[model samples]
Every structure is written in structure tokens, then in C-alpha cells.
Target chain A: MAQVVAVTMTVNGVKSTHHPEPRTLLVHYLREKLGLTGTHVGCDTSQCGSCTVHVDGMAIKSCTMFAVQAEGANVTTIEGMGEIGHLHALQTGFWEEHGLQCGFCTPGMIMSSADLLSHNPNPSESEIRHALEGNFCRCTGYHNIVKAVQNAAHSMAQSAMAQAADD
Target chain B: MYTSEFTYHKASSVSDALAQLASNPDAKLLAGGHSLIPTMKLRLASPSALIDVSSLPELRGIRTEGDTIIIGAMTTHRELEFSKVPLLSEVARLIGDPMVRNKGTIGGALAHADPSADYPAAILALNAKIKIQSSSGARVVTADEFFQGMFTTALAPGEMLVEIHVPASVKGAAYEKFAHPASRYAVAGVAVVVHSDGSLRAAVTGAGDHAMRLTKLESEGVSSACKGLVSASDLMGDHFASAEYRAHLVDVMASKALARAK
Candidate 1:
């Protein structure tokens, strides 16, 4: 019923090529084809941030984009982030700050927070709240989520300073 | 959510996109895919083919040519948020969210003309112009004439919106909106612009079937107890908001926008 199209994109620092239907969402391409399931789909609609991922270094809802549209993009999923032993700062923050009652929205929260930190390294508490507006955490309120982001920002700043001192 | 299958054509150039449109006739031009893709997923729109114009260099970036600020069709909302382009940047900051802003383009917002979309109010108030291109040639239309009724625009069958031109000297401008909490779409939004000669232009969105100018507010200024902030006849009323409530919002939002305009 659909014509298959060849799409090639860099995923999590790995080059992958796949033939998919023109209508296949990038989220599906990641989950079904690449077997990367960290990015959840709380809502297939664009309203939920669970499917958020970095495309060419910018956070976008993967479900809103077609795999074919990502023709030559460099996408960074949660899998591309730090591994189990060495988690990204946001991931570490979530663990330490009790950020999740249920872990469904954790990947999107981390991905979106990473984008915010990339632009505004030391965001104020309100800025962190505004940045996480797209991401919804129903099981737990945003109190812990905000704390988690602040915790990550604080640690990341400390690490940067330590690295500068080492240099 | 699986969208209906359609042939995808990644256009290499503006002309290439136009040729694809000319050949397919029913093809929809895809820029950013923020608005169009969601619609396709919902089965609200199912075009047989999509000509991807998101990557065309000819339809990207922002520039200033003399007294006018020219914005390419593919300029994403995130770029405009930091562009410092007067009212546009202020309005762009409030659209959808960070992720949606990253992939949503100004041209896509204008072309889709969802009635509740934010930019129509800002563009109309700023007296911006829309540049449209077809296989025939390119033509510019004033923002006032660009948007038609209810999810419609002046764009023709084979044409695509290419650029937007706004006066560089919009000294005083501001936008205020009562947004839907989850989606951040405007429930009642107002944009006000003060021209160099001190003339006023204001427009309203989300309260009506299509965005329209607040001629009374512009003529009398916000200091006045501007009677009839919006026409009762032209408003949209759903379970979320009543026509009476939206009228009240126009007054409240207009005052807020006017106060912020400097």
C-alpha cells in the first residue's frame, strides 16, 4: 500500500541506512529499525515530549518528523547519551534528585534539558521550568523534575570549573 | 501514529520544488513539517505527495535589505526567537514549545493560517508582506490580504510562500496571548505595533474564524475605553471558550499588549 524509500542518517554516532515507508515516523525508525527504545511515546500527538530527540543538535519531537525527512541528519537519541556506568549529568541528576516516580518521561526530560543547558548553561530555576514546559510528567509533579535539572546544572558547572582548573 | 502514505520528493532547489508542484498539482509544499506533518498524522490532510522545500537555500535565513527585514520561508521559530526582529521575536518566543519551535517555520505557520496560529497577529500588526512564488513568477502580497478565511491563504495551486518583509523601524510592538495550557496555542491573542509616524495597527487571533485587525483599538488607542474590542459576529465559540469570554479577552489582552509596547 506504500512505496518504500531509502533513508540514511547518522544515529547516536553510528551511520545507519534503512528502507522505510515514506510515512514512517523518525521515532518508529529509531525504535523498530535501530532497536533503540529509550525514547518513549506517551502521546503520539506532538503535545507530549516523550519522543523528543536531538536532530542536528536541536531538540524536536521525533514523532512529528518522517524518517525520509531526516535524509542526512545527525540524530542523538537517549541511547547516544552516556551509558549505564557513566550517565549524562541530567541522567545523574534524575537519579540523585528522585526526579521520577515512573521512568516513562525520563528520556525526553533528559533530552530536552540537554538542549536547554547547551544554550543556557546556568539557567535560573524559572528558566528550567519554562524549558521543560513541553515535557509532561504525570506520575510525579514537576517539583522533582525542576530540582533534577537544577542539580544537573550545578554539577555540570562544578565539573567545568574543575576541568578548567586542571587545564 | 502513521500518516497516510505519500510520495516524498526532496527538492534540490526552489525551482525544483516548483516543478514538482507543477507536475503533481496536488502536491503540498513541506517546510519544517511541524504543522503539515501533524495534520497528515491526524488524517486532516492527506496529500498524494509532499515536496520537501525545507532544505532549499533559497528559502532559508533572515536578512535586511534597506528599510525592510526580509525573512526566508524556512526560517524556524527558534531562529526568530533570538533574531531580535521586533514583534516577531517576542511572538516567536511564545509559540508551541522549545521542541516545536525548533522544527516549526514562520512560512509554514503563515501558509497553514490555522486562525489560532500566533504569527498572523504579529505580521498583520507589523504590516508585513508575504512573498509567494510559482512556476509563473514571484509576487508579494501585503499581510492584510494574505490570510483568507479558516485555514486558508492567498496561496494558489502551484505557488509557495517564499519570504516575509517587515518594516525595520517598528519602534513599539508587543504581543500578549491567553494560551491553551497543554498545546500553548492562543485562545485569545493580540499584537500591537506603533509606526514611525505614530500611527497604530493592531490585530487579533484565536478568538475568531480568522485573524482580523482590531480597527477600533488602533483608531482610539488602548488608553480609551475601546468599545467593542472585537465584533461579536466574527467570533468562534467552542466548549473551551465562549464568544462572550473571547470578547472579554480581546480587551484584557489589548491592554496588556499596549502597556508592554514601547
Candidate 2:
């Protein structure tokens, strides 16, 4: 039998509480308990970054951390980024730039890129590639992924400048 | 894919953690959870309980004290990578990806002492001191005396590593590695530190059972001309690279590190 632990977290702007096995990973908790299926698990090992998410504003591979460790923390999944009609800049950039051929790794790539863009609004192409070293995409060969991140950065900067002008 | 059942304890202080460890001999301290969690999931290490110390204020901070920089044990790799400490920060930037850096702690990496871990070479090269705390009090161990073997250290059963102290007298230092493609671990990594007094220390990792000082190269003054001084047996081989190849890469990496230091 496994020891169960009570965890309370603010996931996707919603407060959630649950009791799960202490061994339950944060990835499994988000997928099984919270029903946020956007976070994919390509490799259970920490090597693959398919399960990337934002923990207190920092990108982390969900499979590497236990759910109990995130108690009282704020978690952001891909679903929190935007709705289907109003997609995030990364989502649209990926769509317009053909960043994915298989789409399995898109959520993680986009989520990891989201954290990157927040930290570096105007990352160079090499910087985008370096920031995405952890999150891999078997499809697309990363050429288009690099283009998509650059596209997003350009648009995000334009919007920021637009907002600043309005302000 | 799943870890064995274990209880979780959130430790508020070092004494509280030590008390818990005394009560449960099989309990392990969890810092950053980057190293321990993965091992736990593989069932390679099944502690009866995990004492979470990632958030302990007592074990988190980076400060300069005179000629030495004192870094709290819980300081994450991301913090170190961005910090002003030259050689240490350079080593931190080469560890894993940003996500891994955000969660991997220097103390946890040092305590685990993976054969390919990056910190050991840097610590040994910089002549850093490790501060360990037990229920009795605190003690310091030199980097050479701290690392005993692969997956082993000088830490007593109940003692907690509290801080790392690095001297600031390095004129220049650099770490160079031939990284394993997938894991980014050093296949043959070398750290070279040139002290302000013109003396040097050299350390190698991922080329042996544990990170070790390359005394021959240090004595020879860490130059491109010292490649022939390294012995073949010091290099390790596996599915990744042959011992001969690793020895070759050691020379290559050491030369690169020396160039960067210069």
C-alpha cells in the first residue's frame, strides 16, 4: 500500500485539492486527477521534456517532480495559455510556421517556449534554439520550430510596443 | 515508472530534519527533487520517507564573505548560473537544460555524486569547501576529502550538507566537456582554475569512477603541452566511448578548458 498525501494547488487559475499517492508525479496528477490532458508524456525519464509546465512561473518537466512537492504552488498547463479562438502567440506561430508535422510535441514545445518568451521577449534565433534544448520535437526537424519562436517573438514585441504606446 | 510507497515529511529547520532522520533511519532528504525523484521512480532508491528541504531558508542563499563566497546548499543551478561567481556559474550554465537548471540544486548534485555530474570538477578545481551540519553541530570538509567515490561522499548518515565555500582568488577558470548527446552529461569534462598567484588546479569528470583532480596536469601547469602526462587507466569506458577514446577526449577537453582559462 502507498502512503497518500493531501495537496492543494492553484492550477490554471483555479484552486484544487486532492489526496493522492505520495509517489504520484505532477504529470500524472495533472493528467489523471485534474483532467488537463494537454501536457503529453513522451518519456517517463527526465530526459524528454514533453511534460513541461510552469511551476510558480518557471518551466519544469512535470515527470521530474512529485505532486506533493507542488502543494500550495501555482501551476500552469498548456490549456491556461488561451482558448481555441484566441490562441497564444506560440500556438498561432506554430500553426502559421508549420512548426509540427506530428503535433504530439507541440504542447510541450509551446509551453516551454511560452516561459522562454516571457523571460526573453526578443530572443535571437540561436537563443530560441538554446532555450528549447530541453523540449524536443522529433517531427519538423526544429527548423520550423525555430522560425515559429522567432515569429512569436516578433509579434509579441510588436504587441508590447503597441500596448506601451496606448498606455 | 512509479516509485515505491514512501511517507513525505516537510522539514522546517535543519534540527527538525535531523530529528526526523534519527527517528526514521531510511529517510532521505529531498532538495530540488531533480536527482532523487528520478532515482525513486526507477525504484533504484526506495527511502522509507523523504524529508523535503528544498524550501528551507536556512539552506538557501548566496553571499560573499571576504575572499570566499558562501553558497547555501539548496541554491539551485539556475541561481548559480546567473550569479556573478565566474567559474562556478560557468559550470552551472553547462549542466542540463533550463528546466533542469531551475530545479537541480548544487548540494543535491554534490551529495548524489554521479560520475558524470559537473559540479565535482568545478568544486575540486576551485578548492571549494563543503559545510556539513549534523545534530551535534557543523563541520567543513575540503572538496578533495568530501568526494569519496561514485554515488558516495564524506557525509555521515544523519548529517546534512549546508553550504559550499569557494575562494575568490582565481585569476581565470573554465570548464570544458565532451557532452553525451542525449543526457548532456560530460563524457570527458575538465575544469581548470588558474589562481591569482599563477599556480593552477585541474580536475576531470566523466572520465573516471568519480571526479578527480589531475595532479599531473596541475604540476605541469595546465598547458597544451601536458596532454601526454595523463594515464590511460584513469579514463572509464562504456557503451558511450572506449577508455582510449575517453582518455583522448580528456586531453582534448583539458586543452579546451586551459584555452578558455587563458
Candidate 3:
């Protein structure tokens, strides 16, 4: 076994501390050590965005980085997106729009979509497609996935407007 | 897939990173780890250690010194994509995707010097100056002299790329690439820049073993004479694109970028 290193990061909202081999990837660390299985590993290669997670609020492929590299960073995994009772807008969008079929790519799709919405609250159809170029959805064929993002954008905007009205 | 086990050291500063590099002769300077990590995972490169300079404040932002734009080594592709830099923003936007851009740094890309990487095309065309730091001293080199060969650079031992200095006066620049559908690696990327002197500069990437000056286009003035400037013998052929096909692409992309370069 390689030398184990102490890794500390704030995942979702809780600070996590673990000891793993320095070679362990962030995706594996999240799944194996932290037990956050929501972030899938569709392809071990970096090409697949299935392990997408927000590192310091910016989406990145988890498999491309090591666990220790994320030390002192704030990470947001799929499990952190929302609870079962209180789902995120994209989570609801995926469910309502049937954005997934086999569901292998759902976590990554939702994570990447949320990343897009965070930056550009209102993205065009082409913009949505462009943003999702890193993630692969073999089962969904991307139609429902695109619709899900569009739906989320609409709902998120509506809620923002509602909050503004309250303000 | 996991990278081979290696010692990790996070450097506190550029000098500290250089000291680490000096001590660990086989250590690799880790920036975004977008390219190096992937390569390491495949066991193509198994460095003994990784000196993490990703968080060093000395290598972290974009600033302007008179007419030169100084881009730090740790500036991520995402920053470049949204930055007001002319040809560089266009080139950076076409690299990988949003997620990859969010972590991959410009300095890492240039230092890695992947033959098919996008930034070299723009860097060469813009005549950018690369700032390199080492235990010996710090020195600046133009983009042309910096890229030595495939996966090779002008940096000597214990040296690392620290910043890129680009002229702020570049105008009417454009980058056109036929990116690989799956990997997004450039199949043939051409960057065109219209110099203030009314002259034109162009560089080619992906089609060859390294990014190189499209001297014919520069000499021919970004005109129709750029046709057949690419020689098939100088390019690499894969299943996706043949050397001859890539040669054709260089010509077509150069002209397309030229049409937009004004």
C-alpha cells in the first residue's frame, strides 16, 4: 500500500476528514471513504463527466483530481444537492422531465446542469447543449436531459421572481 | 483508474516549489492536473512526487503591465474563457468543456506542451512571451522558442513556467479548430492575428507533432495563397483524420480564421 495521507474537505455542508492513499482519486474517495455514492463513476477516464462535483463552487470531474488535492476545498456532491424530501430544482426537473432512463448519468447530469444554471441562470437550448458537452448520457439521448435543464431554468427563475416579490 | 502512488508536497511559494523540485529531482510540478493526472493514470508517466503549486498566490491572476497582459501560471481556463483577452478567450473557450476548463490552468497547458493543445496555436500567433522560474534564475522566452518538440519545452531542470505575457495591442484575431468529437483535442487548430503593422501571423496545432508557425500564411499575408501551405508529410495521421486530411484542414481552418481575422 502507498503512504496514506490525511485529507480534509468540506463536502456538501459538512467537513470530512479521511486517511487514504495519496493515489486515491476524489471520486473514489467520495464513494469509498465518505460513502457518498451519488457521484457515479461511469467512465474511469476523465472524458466522462459522471463524477462531476463542484470544487469551491466550480464543477470539475472528480476522477481527474486526487483526494488530497482537494484539501481545504469546499466540495458539493450529488448527495449534497438536496435531501429526498427537499429536492433541488434540477433534481425535480430531472424527475418531472424524465431526464434519465438507466440513471447512471443522472447525478452527473444534474450536477453539471446545476453548475450551468449557477453561472448563467437563463441559457439557450444551444448554450445548454454546449455546457453539457463534457457529460455523457447514453441512455437518455439528451432530449429529456436538455428539457430537464430548461425546465429547471424556468422554475429557478420563477422562484427568484417570487423571492423578489417577497423582498 | 488511479494514478500510480507518488509523494505529494504542497509548496508555499514559487521559491519553495523550486526548492522542492531541486530536492526531489524526479518531482513534477502539479498545477491543474488536468493533463498530467490523466497521463499518470494511464501509467505513461509515473513521477516520484508531485510538488503542488496549484495554490501558490505568486501564480494566480491576470494583470496588465503597460501594453503587456501578464497571465499567471495558475490562471484556470475558465478565467481565460471569460477574460477580455482577444484571441486567447476564443481559443480557451474551444478547449475541452466547461468542467475541464474550470480546473485546467493555462500555465499547465503550455508547460505540458501537448502537440494538439489549443493554447499553443494562439500563443504562437500572438507571439506571447513565457516567463519561466528556476533555482538558477527567471527568464522570458517567446512562444516560438519555448516549444521545442512534442511534449518538450525550453525549460531546463528545476524550472517551471510561471506566467505568459501577451501584447495587449493584438486586434482582429481569431481561432478556428476542428476539435476531436470525443476528446475535444484539436485535429487542426489555426490562430490568426492581424498585427497593428497590418501584417498577419498564423500558427498551426494538432496537425503536426508540435504547434508551429504557418510561415507560408505569414509570408503570403493571410490570403488565398495560404492554400497548399500545409504539407501532409509534416502531419500525423490517425483513424479519425489522415495526415493528408489534416493537411487539408490546416489550409481550410487557416483561411476560415483569416476570413474572420479582418
Candidate 4:
């Protein structure tokens, strides 16, 4: 008696509907049904943060939520974040600061870091470390990851200031 | 891993959720779904249906009524962490990582009653009360009577927890915990609160099968008397630490929290 439910959500600024099993995790739905594979499933148990995404403007582990639960919510995955040419500041920070090695955890890391920067435009070194407690990166010893987030934070702040000055 | 198939019902109100729960033989109330969904994926639980109570407008606010602060069950940890309630905000900050905090709720955490969970310690120390409702009516239970054992609560089968009530005038309170490196759950945690009358209450979690008040410390009537109050038999331990080590940690964590409260 498998149940299927229809869920409608706004993803990457587009309204969409999905008919998935009630048991289908949001992460699986994003990667399989929508072909949005940028959201990885590092640990199905929700420990690893490779499946992180923004739901209603907050970072959450998509693997832990059912697709049906996200009905009418706004979701943002890595694919929706930025394109290859028009990269998000976090993507560029990782590229410039050597934040990642294998690139497996970059999407989730960037999403979580983006959330931290948005909530706190300026975060200290320890604040960045504390904010990233859920996200695990087995590569680069996390030093470069911290540096990357710091770089992105500064860049985003400066751009906002520049835009204000222009205005 | 994927969870076994189950029907989902999005309830618009508490009465609607209660009706669904009563109709389904093995229905579970879903609030935030952090604890239940993970267990379902592991096949630990197989509910016939899930009654989604996360969207109920009545169960989602923080307000003060007279001398008590009432917190709606669906209120997320992120909301409580930044709320005007000082003791709650302090404890909510240490519940889990940012993402977990974003999705976890106070009522869900209390109902789940994970032995290592952070809320039980603070709730017990603050002498909080839980408000639960059913199709028949609603009733309140004190924190001491609400928690029965690990993953067990006093909530009846058809009942859903709706709010948490705490005294508004806590003179001083603090929480201290030694978080597990991997899961970030507390290995040993203590919450101490000094009431307006100057009597102190202390509760310890993660060192036992369920959160319980440190009666010895309370009997001493002061924070400084908490040292050497915990015995080895008072703690339960696993691969992370031994009973003896946890007993020692209970003392250390309690002392640090007591100092902060003082």
C-alpha cells in the first residue's frame, strides 16, 4: 500500500509540481525526479551535510525530509544557485582559496556557507567554524574551507557596499 | 536509505490532526520530522500514516501569559534560540548544528526524549510543563511527570503535544555539555537554574537512560554543594565513555554550569 502524494514547490525561482512516493526523501526527489544531482547524499543518516539545501530560505538536510513535507515551500539547490559562467560568490571562493579537493562536498558546503553569510554578513573565524559544525569536509583539513567562507563573506559585503555607493 | 511507504495527511488544525490520528490504527504525528523520519528510514518504525502537524497555526508561537512563557510545539529551535526567553535561548543554541536547529522543534525534541537530547535537561531544571491535546480535550503535565524513559513520553496514543510552559522569572540559569565529536549529542550535560526564591534545581542528561534531576545537588540547596554529589552508579555509559568517566563528567559539567548560574 505505497502512497503517492502530489507536492508543489518553488525551486530556483520556478514553480513546479512532483508526484512522488510519500516515503521519497526530498534529496532523492531533487536528484532523481528533477535530475538535480547537484544535491549529493553523503550519509543517508543525516550526519554528513552533503545533502544540504535551502528550504524556505534556511539551510536544511534534504535527506531528512520527505518530499511531501516540502509542499508549497521554496527550495534552492546548487544547480539553482549559480551557473558555470555566472558563479555564486561561494563557488568562486572555493575555486580561489582551494577550499575543496575532490569537489564532492562543495555543493553542500557552499550552500551551508551561503546561509551562514546571509544570516551573519560578517562572521569571525570561530563563528565560521561553529556555523559549519554540521557540514563535514574530509578534504583540505577544513583550513581552506574556513578561508573560503571568509573570502566569500568579505566579497559579498564589499559588493553590497559598492552597490549602495552606486545607488 | 529510504523509508517504508506511508500515507501523509496535512492537518490544518489540531482537531483535524486528532481526528486523523484517531482514525488511523498506527498513525504518528509529524512535527519537524527530524527524529521520526530518520528512524523510519532505518526501518525502526513503520507507521501506517503520518499526520503532519507542522503547519498548524495554533501550534506555532512564543508568548508570555502572566508569569508563564508559553511556547508552541511547532516552534523551531532557530526561533527559540533567538527568542526573548533567556533560559530557553541558552539551551536551544546547543541542541545541534545549525541545520538541525533550523528543522528541530522544542515539542518534537521533548516528545522524542532522546537520552542525549539537550532540551530534557533544561526543561527538567526549569520545571517546565507540557500541554497536550486530543479530540476529547487538552491537559498539562509537569516535566518531571512527562518523561518516562528513553524515547518514551507521557503523551497518550491519540494525543499530540501542543505547547511548553515555563516560568517567566528565572533569576539565573545556565547549560553546559560535553558534545560527542561526531553526532554532536551531549555525552554529559547539566542544566542549573536558580529560582527567584534562591533555591536551585539541577538536572543531568546524556549520563543516564533518561534525564533526571540531580536530587543530591538540589538537597544541598546551593550550587557549590554539587561537587562530589554524583556517584558511578548514577551514570550510564557506552562506547564513547565509561560509567566512571561519565560520573566524573556529570560533576564537572554540573560544577561549571552552577558557577555560571551563580
Candidate 5:
């Protein structure tokens, strides 16, 4: 059997370290080791984005990456987006617009959306669809999810403008 | 599903990686892990050791030198999708979803040599060259020469692809694919590169085990006029796709891509 090794990295703005089996997946590392279970795993194959996370400011399917591969990288899961009091624009849009049903894919969808907006603050509808193509939601039929992204874009733009005006 | 137990060695530099590879001949280089991890979980590949080359600084980023654009092997699909180079960025955006793009690397994809992959066609159309390094030294191979057949490449044992170089003279390049519903890989994809003189070159993926250039047709002086082009149906007779269907798609997609370029 292979031996486990210690891995160090930054997660959710916190420096962290852990020992994991060489075969341990990044999804398992986040959900089990780091106690951040918001990321879901719908399909073990990389086809499903349920295990999506941001590694070094880019969206990636954590299930397809080994935990040790994330060593020294900055990772952000759904848990890092917001908390009880403050909601990220994506969370607010989804909550208000009924973007989810089964909720199994919410965290991944939200995480992917955040990654998209972080790169392109204003994306067209087709671009939004293209961005979310990797993420699959079986319950909501994607109508509300698209609406949620559009709404979030507007909210984010307004907030950005407000901050710009203050400055 | 879970992966089998295996030793992991993270090499900080290219020399260290070469030493690890030389010591463990059965070791596989680990980059994005998008393709390798899934195969491991499925028990299709059970290497004794994994040489982690993801952190090799020399194997990341995109820059231009002289007449060629050099893209480090470890550059992720996300980086490519957001690249300032229009052709590279468009090709990157055509890959699977954002998550897949984030972790999948150009080197990993080329090494895997999945014929249905979009990048192969793009690289083939752009006439890119792949560079490989090992303990012995480094060697360069063209994209067409690198890919041998289905799931096969020209890489020798212990050799790792380090960079891909594309000539800057290429202009008016575009990629289009009919993605499979589940995997998002191209069922039949075509990438077309047109020179300023209207000379055209095309590469097709998802039609065979390895991406192939339509040299027979190109040599026949297939013009940008989009008239009398070969159909996907005529190009089939291979394992992955039928000749007639692929021929028809070739006509449709090639014309569409050409039109889009205009």
C-alpha cells in the first residue's frame, strides 16, 4: 500500500495542512478533511460539475484532481462565498429567484457562477449558458438558474457602480 | 469509485521530475489530473507512482518568442480560454465546462491524445509543434507527427511534453464541434485556418482514433468558395464514426466554420 503524505495549501482564505492518501481526491479533501462539505459530488466522472471549486482563482472539478495536487494552491469552495448575515450576489439571486430544487447542484452552480463573474463581470445570456454548461442541474430545468445568473449580474453591476461612486 | 493506492512524488523542478521518472519507469506524470484521475478511479490505469509536475514553474504560462507563440504545458484550459490570443482563447472556450477547463492542461490533453478532444484539432489546424523533455535532453515534434492513432502518441518512455509552439503567421482560425451530450467531447469537430491569401487548412477530430488533417482534399485545391466540399458521410469508415455521416458533417461544419471566419 502507498503511504499518506502531508499537503499544505490555502483554503477559504485560511492556511491549512493535512495528511491524505495519495489517491484521495480534492473533493474528499475539502468535504472530509477540511470540514467544508458544501461541494457536492453527483458523478464520479468529471462530466458533472457538482464537485466544482476554485483553485487559484479558477473554477475546477475537484473530483478529477487529487488532493495532493492542490498543494500550495489557493482553493475556494462554496462555503467561502458567504455566511449567515451576508450573502454573495449569486446566493441572493438564487434564493430570491428559486434557482434550485433538489439543491444537490446548488453549491457547484454557485461556485462556477462566481468564477465566471469574477472573470467577466458582464456576460451575455449565451455566454452565461456556455459558462454553466459543465454544471448540470436535473431539478430546476435551468430556466430559473439562468434567471438567477442574469439577476446576479445586475446586482453585482449595481454594487460595483455604487462602490465606484463612493470612491 | 476510488483510486488504487499509489506513491506520489511532487517534483519542484524539471530535473527532479526527470529523476523521479527515471527511478520509476512505470510512473506517470500528473498535471491537471482531469484525465488521469478519472482513469485511475475506473481502474483503467494503475501506475506504481505518480510524478506530480503540476507545480513546475517552467511548464506554465503563455508567451511569444520570435515567430512562435510558446504555451507552457501546464497552462490550464481556463488560462487558455481567457487568453489574449483570439484563436487560442476561442479554442479554450470550446473545451468542456469551466470546471474541466480550470484543471485540464494542454500537455495532459495532448499526452492523453483523445481523438475527440477539441484542442487536437485546433493545434493541428494551427500547425503547432510540441516540445518534450527527458533526462536525455529535449526534442520537438509537430502536432501531426506527435499523434499516431487512437489513444496513442509519439512520446517515448520517460518523456514529458513541456511546451507547444505555434507560428504567429496564422490568421483567421476558428473551431466548431458537435459535442456529445454526456462527455461534451466532440462527436465530429473541425478547425479551419485560412491564410490572408485565402489558402485553407482543416483538421478534424472525433472522426477517428487520432485527429487527422484533410490533406487529400486540401491538396485538391478545395477553395474558400465552400462549393463541392467533401461531406462527413464520405469521410466515415473509421471506428468512432461512419464514413458517410462524418463526410456530411465535414461539409457542414467546415462550411459553417469558414462562413463564421468571414
Candidate 6:
């Protein structure tokens, strides 16, 4: 066994640090160390997207990466997107469009979708399907998930236009 | 299977990385970790040190230099998805879902040399070249010469793959594959490239121990009609898929790809 090393990173707009074994996965660091339980660990394997998070503005499976690998990188978990008082548009859209069930995959699903919409505001059904292909939702057959992305696309586009009008 | 406690070193430059590799021969170079980390977690591989090369600035980005498109080894699949090179970008987008693409890199995939990987087929079809560097010097190896066998490559110990070079002569290309349900790896994948001079080349992966060029199919001759060069159904064999099933997919995909290319 090797000594645990200390690493520091920016998580969802906050600076945090931890001392973990070199093998400590980023997901474990987030869930156990930081106590941000919003990121679930359904499968420690990379096959499941349950532990997905944004590393340096790109969505990636946290289980596939190590805590030291994220040293000095910016990370965003589900909690960073919204809270009880205010919800991000994608969160609201998922709820309104019924994009989840059982909800084991919702955090990852929402995180991946939010990342997609950030680059492509109005993605087509095919694009949405392609974007979410990495994420698996056993409960919802993804029909409503697609609809949620569509709805969020419209919502995001409308908001952009409104902001432009206000400006 | 956590990585056994090991020292982590971030290399600031190519020379520095090479020096580190030379000094600590047991250290594993960490790229995207899409391939290495999983094995580490399973306790299949445990190195005494992990040299983190993921942040090496020199090993990132994609650009065209003269007649060749030079893609840095560390360029992420997400970066490749948006590359101005349309064919490369499309191939990148088709790789294992978004999260995988977000972190996996072309050089890392090639270096890992997984038989089922998507890029090997494309690289073979494009007739690309791989650049490798060690403490001694650098050399370029053609795609066909680089891959050895299943999870095997021509890379020497302490050598690192640095870049991939695709020629500009390739006018258009397409990659079509039947992905395995679970791992998303190709059951049998084919990539076809047409050159500006009307020449055609084909490469297949997941159909054998390593991605191979379909020389037998390419040499058979293409039609002058500029369409319907070969039927996808004719390309199947007994390796990654049944001979009959692969033949059917090959003919369909190849014909469709030919039609679209025209």
C-alpha cells in the first residue's frame, strides 16, 4: 500500500481538498469525502452513467476517473445545477415532461442533458437520443426523456430570446 | 480495485515525460484512462507509479499541416467531435456514448490496442500514421504496421504514442458498425475511404484479433459507374460476427456509403 496523497480541486464553484489513496475514484471522493450524495454510484463500472459529473465543463463518468486525475480541474455535480428553492430549466422540464421514474438515473440523466443543451440549445430528437445514449434509464423507456430534452430546448430557446429582447 | 498506492507525477513536457519513463520503467502513463483505469480497478494491472500525462499541453489539439491532418495524442473525443475535419468528427461522435467520448482520446485508444475499438478501423481505412516518441527519438509507423494483435501494439516499452496523421488525399469516408449491447464496442466495424483519384480502401475491426485492411475486398475491383461499388452483404466473415450476418451488413452499409459518397 502507498501513502494517501492530498489533492485540491474546484467543485461546483467551490474549492475543496481531500487526502485519498491514489486509487480513490473521483465519484468516491465526491460522494464520500465531500458528502455530495447527489451523485449516485449505481455501478462502480463505467458502464452505468449513475456517477456522471462535469469535469472541466465536460460531462464524464466519475467512476472511470481518479481523484488525483481531477487535480486542479473544475467539476460540477447535480447539486450545482439547482436546489430546492430554484431549479434549473432541465430539472423543471424533466419533472414536467415526466423524464424519470425510480429516479436512480435522474441525476446523471439531467446532468448529461444539461451539458448537451448548453452547446446545442435546440437539439433534434435524434441529437437528444445520441446525447443521452451514454446514460441508461431502466425505468423510463426514454420516450419522455426525449420529450424532456425537446421541452428544455424550447424553454432554453425562449429564455434566450427573452433575454435578448430585454437587452 | 483501487490503484495501489503509487506516486503520481505530472509531466510538463514531452522530454520530461520521456525522462520520467526512462527513470521509472514500471510507471504507467495515464492518458484518458478509459482503458487502463478499468483494468486497474479489476486488479488486472497494478503499476508502482502513475505518470499523469493527461495535462501535457503539447499533446493536445487537431490541425492540418500541409497534406496531413495531425491530431495530437491527448486530444479528447469531445474535441474531435467538433473538429473541422468532418469525417474524423463524425467517427468521433459515433464512439461509445457521450461520457466515454468526453474523456477517451485517439492516441490512448490506439495505444491500448483494443480489438473492438472504433478508431482502429477508421485509422486503418484512412491509412493513417502514428508518431511515437521515447528518450532516444521519434518515429512514424503506418496504421497497418502499428497494430499487432488483440490488446497488442507495436509500441516499445517506455515509448509513448504522440500523434496520428491522416492524409489529405482521402476525399470522403464512412464508418458503420454493429455495436455490442453492453460494452458498446464494435461487434464488427468497417470504415471505407475514397481518395480523390477514384481509389478506394477498406478496413475492418472487431472481426479479428486486430483491425485489418480488407485487401481481398479492395483488390477485387470497383465499378466505373461511381456507384454500387460493393454490396455490404458480401463483407461478412466468421470472426466478430457470423459470416452470413456480417456479409449482409457490409453490403448494405458499403452500398449506402458509396451512394452517399457519390
Interface RMSD of each: 0.8, 0.9, 0.9, 0.8, 1.0, 1.5
Q: In terms of lDDT, which candidate is stronger, 1 or 2?
A: 1
Cα error, residue B54 of model 4, in Å, equals 1.0
lDDT of 6 by residue, B100-187 (tens): 9989998898999988788898888788899999999999999989998888998999899999998865667878777777777877
- The CAPRI quality class of candidate 1 comes to high
True contacts kept of each: 0.89, 0.87, 0.91, 0.94, 0.96, 0.89
TM-score of chain B of each: 0.98, 0.97, 0.98, 0.97, 0.91, 0.88
Q: What does candidate 5's lDDT look like per residue over A1-167, in tens digits?
A: 45999999899999988999989999999999988989988887987789999998888888888888888899998989999889889999999899999899999999999988987888888888889999999999898998999899999999989999999
DockQ-superior candidate, 2 or 3: 3
Q: Estimate each model's TM-score.
A: 0.98, 0.98, 0.98, 0.98, 0.93, 0.93
Question: In candidate 3, which residue pairs clash?
Answer: none
The candidates' DockQ values read: 0.88, 0.86, 0.88, 0.89, 0.84, 0.78
Candidate 4 residue spans exceeding 4 A from truth: none
CA lDDT of every candidate:
0.91, 0.90, 0.92, 0.90, 0.84, 0.83
Of 4 and 5, the candidate ranking higher by TM-score: 4
Q: What is the lDDT of residue A160 in candidate 2?
A: 89
lDDT per residue for candidate 2 within B117-209, as digits (tens), equals 999999999999999998888999999999989889999998999999998668999999999998999998999999888889999999898
- Rank by DockQ, highest first: 4, 1, 3, 2, 5, 6
lDDT of 5 at A59: 85
Error of 1 at B229 (Å): 1.5
Task: State residue A129's C-alpha deviation in candidate 5, in Å.
Answer: 0.9
lDDT of 1 by residue, B147-197 (tens): 888998999899999999999887699999999877789999999998877
Model 5, range B8-101, lDDT digits (tens) per residue?
A: 9988898899989988889999998888888999999999899999878999999989877899999998888877754678888878888888
Give the Å shift of residue B171 in candidate 6.
2.6
The RMSD of every model to the true structure, in order and in angstroms, is 1.0, 1.1, 1.0, 1.1, 2.4, 3.0
How many angstroms is residue B22 displaced in model 2 relative to the true structure, after the best TM-score fit? 1.7
